[model samples]
Target: MNHLKALLIKFVMIAVVLIVVLTLIFDVPFMDSIWTSLVLTVLAYILGDFLLFRLAANRSSQNVRNMIATGGDIIIAFLTIWYMQVALVDANGSIALGSFIAAVIIGAGEWFFHKYLDGNVVSKNTRTTADLEADYKK
Candidate 1:
Protein backbone atom coordinates (compact mmCIF):
# COMPACT_ATOMS: atom_id res chain seq x y z
CA MET A 1 0.00 0.00 0.00
CA ASN A 2 2.91 2.32 0.67
CA HIS A 3 4.30 1.66 -2.75
CA LEU A 4 0.87 2.17 -4.20
CA LYS A 5 0.64 5.61 -2.69
CA ALA A 6 4.14 6.43 -3.84
CA LEU A 7 3.32 5.23 -7.34
CA LEU A 8 0.17 7.30 -7.44
CA ILE A 9 2.15 10.35 -6.33
CA LYS A 10 4.66 9.63 -9.02
CA PHE A 11 1.88 9.41 -11.57
CA VAL A 12 0.48 12.78 -10.57
CA MET A 13 3.90 14.39 -10.71
CA ILE A 14 4.74 12.89 -14.07
CA ALA A 15 1.31 13.72 -15.42
CA VAL A 16 1.77 17.35 -14.47
CA VAL A 17 5.18 17.40 -16.03
CA LEU A 18 4.00 15.78 -19.25
CA ILE A 19 0.92 17.93 -19.47
CA VAL A 20 2.94 21.08 -19.03
CA VAL A 21 5.40 19.91 -21.65
CA LEU A 22 2.66 19.04 -24.14
CA THR A 23 0.98 22.36 -23.54
CA LEU A 24 4.22 24.18 -24.10
CA ILE A 25 5.17 22.26 -27.22
CA PHE A 26 1.78 21.88 -29.01
CA ASP A 27 -0.40 24.24 -27.02
CA VAL A 28 -2.79 21.37 -26.40
CA PRO A 29 -4.95 21.28 -23.34
CA PHE A 30 -3.57 18.01 -22.09
CA MET A 31 -5.87 18.03 -19.09
CA ASP A 32 -8.81 16.69 -21.07
CA SER A 33 -7.40 13.19 -20.84
CA ILE A 34 -5.11 13.52 -17.83
CA TRP A 35 -7.03 11.48 -15.23
CA THR A 36 -6.98 8.30 -17.25
CA SER A 37 -3.40 8.81 -18.30
CA LEU A 38 -2.34 9.35 -14.72
CA VAL A 39 -4.02 6.20 -13.47
CA LEU A 40 -2.51 4.15 -16.28
CA THR A 41 0.89 5.65 -15.64
CA VAL A 42 0.69 4.80 -11.94
CA LEU A 43 -0.29 1.20 -12.60
CA ALA A 44 2.56 0.83 -15.07
CA TYR A 45 5.00 2.39 -12.66
CA ILE A 46 4.02 -0.01 -9.87
CA LEU A 47 4.28 -2.98 -12.22
CA GLY A 48 7.71 -1.87 -13.35
CA ASP A 49 8.89 -1.44 -9.80
CA PHE A 50 7.74 -4.90 -8.90
CA LEU A 51 9.38 -6.50 -11.94
CA LEU A 52 12.57 -4.48 -12.19
CA PHE A 53 13.36 -3.56 -8.61
CA ARG A 54 11.63 -6.06 -6.39
CA LEU A 55 12.17 -9.05 -8.67
CA ALA A 56 15.43 -8.26 -10.40
CA ALA A 57 16.97 -6.87 -7.29
CA ASN A 58 20.07 -8.04 -5.38
CA ARG A 59 23.00 -8.45 -7.77
CA SER A 60 26.66 -7.65 -7.97
CA SER A 61 26.65 -5.34 -10.93
CA GLN A 62 25.79 -1.72 -10.17
CA ASN A 63 25.08 -1.25 -13.85
CA VAL A 64 22.53 -4.02 -13.66
CA ARG A 65 20.82 -2.33 -10.74
CA ASN A 66 20.69 0.98 -12.54
CA MET A 67 19.59 -0.73 -15.71
CA ILE A 68 16.70 -2.29 -13.87
CA ALA A 69 15.68 1.03 -12.45
CA THR A 70 15.91 2.73 -15.83
CA GLY A 71 14.05 -0.08 -17.50
CA GLY A 72 11.27 0.40 -15.00
CA ASP A 73 10.87 4.01 -16.02
CA ILE A 74 10.85 3.21 -19.72
CA ILE A 75 8.37 0.44 -19.17
CA ILE A 76 6.17 2.79 -17.22
CA ALA A 77 6.14 5.38 -19.99
CA PHE A 78 5.42 2.93 -22.77
CA LEU A 79 2.78 1.13 -20.75
CA THR A 80 1.15 4.40 -19.86
CA ILE A 81 0.95 5.44 -23.50
CA TRP A 82 -0.11 2.04 -24.69
CA TYR A 83 -2.80 1.23 -22.15
CA MET A 84 -4.21 4.73 -22.22
CA GLN A 85 -4.54 4.52 -25.98
CA VAL A 86 -5.92 1.01 -26.08
CA ALA A 87 -8.26 0.53 -23.14
CA LEU A 88 -9.25 4.07 -22.20
CA VAL A 89 -8.56 6.31 -25.12
CA ASP A 90 -9.57 6.66 -28.77
CA ALA A 91 -7.09 9.12 -30.26
CA ASN A 92 -3.90 8.41 -32.11
CA GLY A 93 -1.14 10.74 -31.10
CA SER A 94 2.31 9.36 -31.60
CA ILE A 95 5.80 9.91 -30.37
CA ALA A 96 8.86 9.43 -32.52
CA LEU A 97 10.56 6.22 -31.44
CA GLY A 98 14.04 7.61 -31.80
CA SER A 99 13.19 10.72 -29.83
CA PHE A 100 11.49 8.68 -27.14
CA ILE A 101 14.52 6.42 -26.84
CA ALA A 102 16.77 9.45 -26.61
CA ALA A 103 14.65 10.90 -23.85
CA VAL A 104 14.82 7.65 -21.90
CA ILE A 105 18.56 7.55 -22.27
CA ILE A 106 18.84 11.13 -21.14
CA GLY A 107 16.63 10.49 -18.15
CA ALA A 108 18.66 7.47 -17.12
CA GLY A 109 21.90 9.36 -17.53
CA GLU A 110 20.60 12.20 -15.44
CA TRP A 111 19.46 9.79 -12.73
CA PHE A 112 22.84 8.04 -12.66
CA PHE A 113 24.68 11.36 -12.59
CA HIS A 114 22.62 12.50 -9.64
CA LYS A 115 23.29 9.26 -7.81
CA TYR A 116 26.98 9.58 -8.51
CA LEU A 117 27.02 13.06 -7.05
CA ASP A 118 25.49 11.62 -3.92
CA GLY A 119 28.68 9.74 -3.03
CA ASN A 120 27.98 7.01 -5.53
CA VAL A 121 25.56 5.60 -3.02
CA VAL A 122 22.95 3.94 -5.20
CA SER A 123 22.08 1.12 -2.86
CA LYS A 124 19.03 1.75 -0.75
CA ASN A 125 20.20 -0.88 1.70
CA THR A 126 23.31 1.19 2.23
CA ARG A 127 21.52 4.46 2.60
CA THR A 128 17.84 5.27 2.78
CA THR A 129 15.52 8.24 2.62
CA ALA A 130 15.22 8.33 6.36
CA ASP A 131 18.95 8.00 6.76
CA LEU A 132 19.55 11.02 4.59
CA GLU A 133 16.99 13.04 6.40
CA ALA A 134 18.50 12.07 9.72
CA ASP A 135 21.99 12.90 8.53
CA TYR A 136 20.79 16.31 7.50
CA LYS A 137 19.22 16.94 10.84
CA LYS A 138 21.31 19.90 11.95
Candidate 2:
Protein backbone atom coordinates (compact mmCIF):
# COMPACT_ATOMS: atom_id res chain seq x y z
CA MET A 1 0.00 0.00 0.00
CA ASN A 2 2.81 2.42 0.84
CA HIS A 3 4.72 1.44 -2.25
CA LEU A 4 1.62 1.78 -4.34
CA LYS A 5 1.00 5.31 -3.09
CA ALA A 6 4.60 6.21 -3.74
CA LEU A 7 4.39 4.81 -7.25
CA LEU A 8 1.27 6.82 -7.93
CA ILE A 9 2.93 10.02 -6.76
CA LYS A 10 5.98 9.30 -8.84
CA PHE A 11 3.86 8.49 -11.87
CA VAL A 12 2.08 11.79 -11.59
CA MET A 13 5.34 13.69 -11.26
CA ILE A 14 6.98 12.00 -14.24
CA ALA A 15 3.84 12.10 -16.33
CA VAL A 16 3.41 15.83 -15.88
CA VAL A 17 6.99 16.53 -16.82
CA LEU A 18 6.95 14.19 -19.80
CA ILE A 19 3.65 15.53 -21.02
CA VAL A 20 4.88 19.10 -20.91
CA VAL A 21 8.36 18.50 -22.26
CA LEU A 22 7.68 15.74 -24.78
CA THR A 23 4.27 16.88 -25.99
CA LEU A 24 4.18 20.62 -25.50
CA ILE A 25 7.79 21.35 -26.31
CA PHE A 26 8.87 18.46 -28.52
CA ASP A 27 5.49 18.03 -30.21
CA VAL A 28 5.09 14.37 -29.30
CA PRO A 29 1.59 13.01 -29.31
CA PHE A 30 -0.27 13.21 -25.98
CA MET A 31 -0.86 9.48 -25.80
CA ASP A 32 2.77 8.78 -26.62
CA SER A 33 3.84 11.07 -23.82
CA ILE A 34 1.57 9.20 -21.41
CA TRP A 35 2.91 5.85 -22.55
CA THR A 36 6.47 7.02 -22.23
CA SER A 37 5.67 8.43 -18.80
CA LEU A 38 4.19 5.10 -17.70
CA VAL A 39 7.23 3.16 -18.87
CA LEU A 40 9.72 5.70 -17.52
CA THR A 41 7.96 5.88 -14.14
CA VAL A 42 8.07 2.12 -13.57
CA LEU A 43 11.64 1.74 -14.78
CA ALA A 44 12.90 4.69 -12.76
CA TYR A 45 11.14 3.63 -9.56
CA ILE A 46 12.52 0.10 -9.83
CA LEU A 47 16.05 0.84 -10.98
CA GLY A 48 16.64 4.37 -9.68
CA ASP A 49 14.53 4.63 -6.52
CA PHE A 50 14.09 1.05 -5.33
CA LEU A 51 17.51 -0.34 -6.15
CA LEU A 52 20.05 2.43 -6.63
CA PHE A 53 18.74 4.91 -4.09
CA ARG A 54 18.30 2.31 -1.37
CA LEU A 55 21.75 0.85 -1.89
CA ALA A 56 23.41 4.24 -2.11
CA ALA A 57 21.63 5.55 0.96
CA ASN A 58 23.03 2.74 3.05
CA ARG A 59 26.59 3.71 2.13
CA SER A 60 26.67 7.37 1.21
CA SER A 61 25.58 10.86 2.15
CA GLN A 62 22.13 12.06 1.11
CA ASN A 63 23.68 14.28 -1.55
CA VAL A 64 25.64 11.38 -2.94
CA ARG A 65 22.59 9.16 -2.92
CA ASN A 66 20.59 11.81 -4.71
CA MET A 67 23.28 12.20 -7.32
CA ILE A 68 23.53 8.50 -7.95
CA ALA A 69 19.79 7.98 -8.16
CA THR A 70 19.26 11.08 -10.22
CA GLY A 71 21.92 9.99 -12.67
CA GLY A 72 20.32 6.59 -12.93
CA ASP A 73 16.93 8.14 -13.50
CA ILE A 74 18.39 10.36 -16.20
CA ILE A 75 19.81 7.40 -18.04
CA ILE A 76 16.58 5.48 -17.67
CA ALA A 77 14.53 8.39 -18.94
CA PHE A 78 16.86 8.98 -21.87
CA LEU A 79 16.83 5.40 -23.09
CA THR A 80 13.11 4.97 -22.57
CA ILE A 81 12.16 8.18 -24.30
CA TRP A 82 14.62 7.66 -27.12
CA TYR A 83 13.32 4.19 -27.89
CA MET A 84 9.73 5.29 -27.52
CA GLN A 85 10.32 8.14 -29.91
CA VAL A 86 11.47 5.75 -32.57
CA ALA A 87 8.91 3.01 -31.97
CA LEU A 88 5.93 5.01 -30.74
CA VAL A 89 6.06 8.77 -30.90
CA ASP A 90 6.15 10.44 -34.32
CA ALA A 91 7.80 13.66 -33.23
CA ASN A 92 9.69 15.70 -35.83
CA GLY A 93 12.93 16.50 -34.08
CA SER A 94 16.22 14.90 -33.16
CA ILE A 95 15.16 12.11 -30.87
CA ALA A 96 18.45 12.03 -29.05
CA LEU A 97 18.39 15.74 -28.28
CA GLY A 98 14.80 15.71 -27.13
CA SER A 99 15.34 12.67 -25.01
CA PHE A 100 18.42 14.18 -23.43
CA ILE A 101 16.59 17.37 -22.60
CA ALA A 102 13.69 15.52 -21.02
CA ALA A 103 16.03 13.22 -19.14
CA VAL A 104 17.93 16.14 -17.68
CA ILE A 105 14.71 17.70 -16.54
CA ILE A 106 13.56 14.49 -14.93
CA GLY A 107 16.92 14.13 -13.21
CA ALA A 108 16.56 17.55 -11.67
CA GLY A 109 13.12 16.66 -10.40
CA GLU A 110 14.27 13.29 -9.09
CA TRP A 111 16.78 14.89 -6.77
CA PHE A 112 13.97 16.54 -4.82
CA PHE A 113 11.76 13.51 -5.15
CA HIS A 114 14.39 11.38 -3.43
CA LYS A 115 14.23 13.64 -0.41
CA TYR A 116 10.49 13.17 -0.29
CA LEU A 117 10.87 9.42 -0.55
CA ASP A 118 13.31 9.28 2.30
CA GLY A 119 10.98 11.21 4.54
CA ASN A 120 7.65 9.68 3.61
CA VAL A 121 7.84 6.69 1.33
CA VAL A 122 10.88 4.61 2.23
CA SER A 123 10.42 2.24 5.13
CA LYS A 124 11.89 3.45 8.42
CA ASN A 125 13.53 0.07 8.91
CA THR A 126 15.67 0.73 5.90
CA ARG A 127 16.99 4.00 7.33
CA THR A 128 19.12 3.75 10.44
CA THR A 129 19.25 6.43 13.11
CA ALA A 130 22.84 7.09 12.11
CA ASP A 131 21.69 7.64 8.56
CA LEU A 132 19.09 10.12 9.67
CA GLU A 133 21.59 11.89 11.87
CA ALA A 134 24.10 12.06 9.09
CA ASP A 135 21.53 13.47 6.70
CA TYR A 136 20.41 15.99 9.28
CA LYS A 137 23.96 17.10 9.91
CA LYS A 138 24.50 17.80 6.25
Candidate 3:
Protein backbone atom coordinates (compact mmCIF):
# COMPACT_ATOMS: atom_id res chain seq x y z
CA MET A 1 0.00 0.00 0.00
CA ASN A 2 2.76 2.42 0.95
CA HIS A 3 4.69 1.64 -2.17
CA LEU A 4 1.54 2.18 -4.14
CA LYS A 5 1.06 5.62 -2.65
CA ALA A 6 4.61 6.66 -3.43
CA LEU A 7 4.24 5.49 -6.98
CA LEU A 8 0.93 7.25 -7.29
CA ILE A 9 2.27 10.52 -5.98
CA LYS A 10 5.26 10.23 -8.26
CA PHE A 11 2.98 9.57 -11.20
CA VAL A 12 0.82 12.58 -10.42
CA MET A 13 3.84 14.80 -10.06
CA ILE A 14 5.14 13.64 -13.38
CA ALA A 15 1.79 14.11 -15.00
CA VAL A 16 1.63 17.68 -13.77
CA VAL A 17 5.11 18.29 -15.08
CA LEU A 18 4.19 16.91 -18.47
CA ILE A 19 1.08 19.04 -18.61
CA VAL A 20 3.09 22.14 -17.82
CA VAL A 21 5.74 21.30 -20.39
CA LEU A 22 3.08 20.93 -23.02
CA THR A 23 1.55 24.28 -22.18
CA LEU A 24 4.94 25.98 -22.36
CA ILE A 25 5.45 24.77 -25.90
CA PHE A 26 2.58 26.98 -27.10
CA ASP A 27 4.17 30.24 -25.91
CA VAL A 28 1.98 30.50 -22.87
CA PRO A 29 2.84 33.33 -20.51
CA PHE A 30 4.65 32.33 -17.33
CA MET A 31 1.44 32.89 -15.45
CA ASP A 32 -0.53 31.02 -18.09
CA SER A 33 1.99 28.28 -18.71
CA ILE A 34 1.55 25.29 -16.47
CA TRP A 35 5.07 24.15 -17.16
CA THR A 36 7.11 27.06 -15.81
CA SER A 37 5.21 27.48 -12.59
CA LEU A 38 5.21 23.75 -12.05
CA VAL A 39 8.90 23.56 -12.75
CA LEU A 40 9.66 26.23 -10.16
CA THR A 41 7.25 24.72 -7.70
CA VAL A 42 8.86 21.36 -8.19
CA LEU A 43 12.29 22.84 -7.77
CA ALA A 44 11.28 24.31 -4.44
CA TYR A 45 9.59 21.15 -3.29
CA ILE A 46 12.48 18.93 -4.27
CA LEU A 47 14.95 21.12 -2.47
CA GLY A 48 12.81 21.34 0.65
CA ASP A 49 12.17 17.60 0.73
CA PHE A 50 15.80 16.79 0.20
CA LEU A 51 16.75 18.99 3.11
CA LEU A 52 14.23 17.27 5.35
CA PHE A 53 15.40 13.84 4.27
CA ARG A 54 18.99 14.70 4.90
CA LEU A 55 18.20 16.18 8.28
CA ALA A 56 16.28 13.06 9.26
CA ALA A 57 18.98 10.71 8.06
CA ASN A 58 21.76 12.60 9.76
CA ARG A 59 20.17 13.41 13.11
CA SER A 60 21.62 12.06 16.35
CA SER A 61 18.39 10.45 17.55
CA GLN A 62 15.26 8.94 16.04
CA ASN A 63 13.01 11.36 17.89
CA VAL A 64 14.99 14.22 16.43
CA ARG A 65 14.58 12.84 12.96
CA ASN A 66 10.81 12.75 13.36
CA MET A 67 10.79 16.34 14.50
CA ILE A 68 13.01 17.43 11.70
CA ALA A 69 10.93 15.73 9.06
CA THR A 70 7.75 17.17 10.44
CA GLY A 71 9.26 20.59 10.59
CA GLY A 72 10.62 20.17 7.10
CA ASP A 73 7.22 19.39 5.64
CA ILE A 74 5.75 22.43 7.27
CA ILE A 75 8.58 24.48 5.90
CA ILE A 76 8.00 23.08 2.45
CA ALA A 77 4.35 24.08 2.59
CA PHE A 78 5.02 27.68 3.57
CA LEU A 79 8.11 28.12 1.43
CA THR A 80 6.28 26.93 -1.63
CA ILE A 81 3.54 29.41 -0.91
CA TRP A 82 6.14 32.11 -0.65
CA TYR A 83 7.63 30.98 -3.90
CA MET A 84 4.33 31.50 -5.65
CA GLN A 85 4.00 35.04 -4.35
CA VAL A 86 7.49 36.10 -5.26
CA ALA A 87 6.45 37.00 -8.83
CA LEU A 88 8.86 34.35 -9.96
CA VAL A 89 5.74 32.59 -11.05
CA ASP A 90 5.07 32.90 -14.78
CA ALA A 91 1.87 32.94 -16.89
CA ASN A 92 -0.14 35.56 -15.06
CA GLY A 93 1.03 33.98 -11.83
CA SER A 94 -1.94 31.66 -11.78
CA ILE A 95 0.19 28.68 -12.68
CA ALA A 96 2.42 29.42 -9.71
CA LEU A 97 -0.62 29.55 -7.52
CA GLY A 98 -1.64 26.21 -8.87
CA SER A 99 1.77 24.81 -8.05
CA PHE A 100 1.46 25.88 -4.43
CA ILE A 101 -1.97 24.35 -4.26
CA ALA A 102 -0.62 21.16 -5.75
CA ALA A 103 2.07 20.74 -3.08
CA VAL A 104 -0.38 20.92 -0.19
CA ILE A 105 -2.77 18.79 -2.15
CA ILE A 106 -0.36 15.86 -2.37
CA GLY A 107 1.72 16.48 0.74
CA ALA A 108 -0.53 14.51 3.04
CA GLY A 109 -0.53 11.59 0.67
CA GLU A 110 3.24 11.50 0.51
CA TRP A 111 3.56 11.96 4.24
CA PHE A 112 1.18 9.12 4.91
CA PHE A 113 2.99 6.94 2.43
CA HIS A 114 6.28 7.64 4.20
CA LYS A 115 4.81 6.95 7.61
CA TYR A 116 3.28 3.67 6.55
CA LEU A 117 6.65 2.52 5.37
CA ASP A 118 8.28 3.37 8.72
CA GLY A 119 5.55 2.44 11.17
CA ASN A 120 7.64 -0.08 13.05
CA VAL A 121 9.84 1.24 15.80
CA VAL A 122 13.08 -0.62 16.27
CA SER A 123 15.36 1.55 18.45
CA LYS A 124 16.14 5.15 19.27
CA ASN A 125 19.31 5.14 17.20
CA THR A 126 18.33 2.83 14.38
CA ARG A 127 17.26 3.91 10.92
CA THR A 128 13.75 2.45 11.13
CA THR A 129 12.63 4.54 14.07
CA ALA A 130 14.25 7.59 12.63
CA ASP A 131 12.60 7.02 9.31
CA LEU A 132 9.28 6.40 11.02
CA GLU A 133 9.56 9.59 12.99
CA ALA A 134 10.45 11.53 9.87
CA ASP A 135 7.28 10.20 8.31
CA TYR A 136 5.21 11.09 11.35
CA LYS A 137 6.30 14.71 11.46
CA LYS A 138 5.55 15.17 7.82
Top model number, lDDT: 2
Clashing pairs in 1: none
RMSD of each: 9.1, 4.5, 8.5
Error of 1 at 97 (Å): 6.5
The candidate that wins on TM-score is 2
- Candidate models: Cα lDDT each: 0.48, 0.84, 0.46
Give the least accurate 10-residue stretch of model 2, judged by summed lDDT. 123-132
How many pairs in model 1 have backbone atoms within 3 A of each other, for residues 3 or more apart or on separate chains, i.e. clashes? 0
Q: Give the CA lDDT, 0 to 100, for residue 93 in model 1.
A: 53
Show model 2 residue runs off by greater than 4 Å. 57-60, 90-93, 127-138
Model 2 per-residue lDDT at 51? 86
Which order, best to worst by TM-score? 2, 1, 3
Candidate 3 lDDT over residue span 1-138, tens digit each: 543454445445534542454244323343433433354346533553434544456344534555555456545644544454344434354545555554454454445533533452222354444566767899
Tell me the TM-score of each prediction against the true structure: 0.52, 0.84, 0.38
In each prediction, how many residue pairs overlap at the backbone (N, C-alpha, C within less than 3 A)?
Answer: 0, 0, 11
Model 1 has an lDDT value of 0.48
Greater lDDT among 1 and 3 belongs to 1
Model 3, residue 137: distance off in Å is: 23
- Comparing candidate 2 with candidate 3, which one achieves the higher lDDT? 2
Residue 113, candidate 1: C-alpha displacement in angstroms: 13
